[model samples]
Target: MNDMDKTRLRINRSLILQEVRIEHVRDFLYQEGIISEEDMDRCGNVTKTPRERIACLLDLLPRRGPEAYKAFCSGLQETYPWVVEKLNSTPIPETQTKTLSSTVLPNKEMNTGETSERQRIREPYTELNHTVIKIVTRSEALNKYKDVVRALGVPQPDIDQIEYANFRDLQEQFYQCLLKWQSREGRNATVVRLIEVLREEDYNSVADKLDGYID
Candidate 1:
């Protein structure tokens, strides 16, 4: 396929993936009465009963062709068995950080002369507990992002490297960094920095194209 055709297919795949994730959330919400039976019914056939429809939607079968959806769901189940479990289970309590203080003396030999030793703040967890929550909460959006990534069929080590909780944070940081980098040094610097931060070839490619017009 031509480049434009390929781009469109990637976009479509992303949209499909996002829809599937949103459907899963919708199913969970419906089960909890967060959404009404009427809204649930509006989602339409993927199953014989309303309850079954929840499963069908989460499985992404109603929209995808049966065979493909089945295979995809199976593969996803294998890859992320905990996804449903986590979604269904109660969310964990948010962790809190504790600040500890240490005695410090100012001396040329003891404290490097002037600056006081900073107290180390211990994190409650090795990583943020909310990372998974954010991932689950934003699954629909991330799934859309994943679709584009999947279409490229190229490894996205950087995207994989980010902690799930940090996805939104990282994106925000990158945007701010891009604005600063672009303003100071122009398009080339901004594109390079964006690629470094995003670590996705597709995003880098797009950033390169948009570089000139960025302020």
Candidate 2:
């Protein structure tokens, strides 16, 4: 089997799906015109867990053709706008620390004389320095990284094979693409962080490596 075939594997796919809420998906599909009200009634039954319902829908939708499949992904993006937003956005450079001028603080919190929660938090801000950060969401991380590929200028067709892929398969592809594009002209903090992720390293360790990049 070829590399793309390997990415289509269903192994461990449910690990991600098990965490999703099916109604959110059904609502999105319906809203996007991917499924009809009648279709929802038939497929949205509570008898199945959210994952199971989605599994069933996953099987059924593709039978309707590629256009329907694209609609499903679009609906999924709507169902979880946060995931899509994270992937779509560009990562800002790290290592610069400047205080929020209290302008950014909510008016009530401004006078509290604190850094204002995360506006002062150390850990999350530090990790942002690593351009090769792992996504917090487990199920969507591969696609989130796939979004990085979109930014990287050229995505091989294997990327498309995972458009509607289940989690584990996409996870495999995520690393594969990252490996192909990895810069070889000596490693920097960002590249190191990417290496850590490719090695399945934990985020905190990766974050610390990233912090070292701070200027």
Candidate 3:
């Protein structure tokens, strides 16, 4: 795949809308000079909701420049390592060029507070990150994510959006639900808590499976 296709393929649009703090993404991209101040304002002001802003941002990235894709990944890696992980996992075709030309942008250091905020967002992912991945993958197969999420009290609108986004693929729908929960809960999205929710949803077998990872 070429850069543009690779860019679109790597970014899980629905997951981004659900999980990413778009403000941080915007700031990072702006600092990298991938997006201009006017672009930033349009992304924020043209869209009312967080989801809309992220969607708008994603739409803007491909058209920004060739380096936009790489810069986007760099910014995401700082605050959303899992997102970068997912993006990197996308398979590139053998025909694709191995060497991508890098364009050096102007140096604009992120301020102390912006740096701190990225650090804060990254901390929660350090623990239980792998476990959450395993659980989401395994739970998707079990097809019980809907029950678990509903029992965990995901808002109806979020649930509706999840259904709408991945209508044809049940597994993807489940994955989206877990991401929604994780994004919404942040540090509170613990493996123990997920297990509890599963059991409460009467999926003890699933809960037991997840419990094994804790030990």
In order, how many clashes per candidate?
A: 0, 0, 0
Q: Evaluated with TM-score, which candidate comes out highest? A: 3
Off by over 4 Å in 3: 1-11, 92-215
Which regions of candidate 2 fall more than 4 Å away from where they truly are?
Answer: 1-12, 78-215
> Residue 189 lDDT in model 2?
20
Two-way lDDT contest, 1 vs 2, winner: 2
Clashes of 3: 0
User: For candidate 1, lDDT tens digit of each residue in 1-215?
Assistant: 12222232333443334334434455444333233344456555554554554444443322221122223334445444554233324232233111111222322334344433331111112121233223322333232343222222212233343324356674433333223333444423322233232333234444443332231
C-alpha RMSD for every candidate: 19.3, 15.8, 18.8
Cα lDDT tens digits, model 3, 52-165, are 888788876654434566777788887898977877776654444333322111112223344455445544443447556566567533464554664444544576687788
Query: How do these models rank on lDDT, best leading?
Result: 3, 2, 1
Q: How does candidate 3 score on lDDT?
A: 0.63
TM-score-best of 1 and 2: 2
Better of 2 and 3 by lDDT: 3
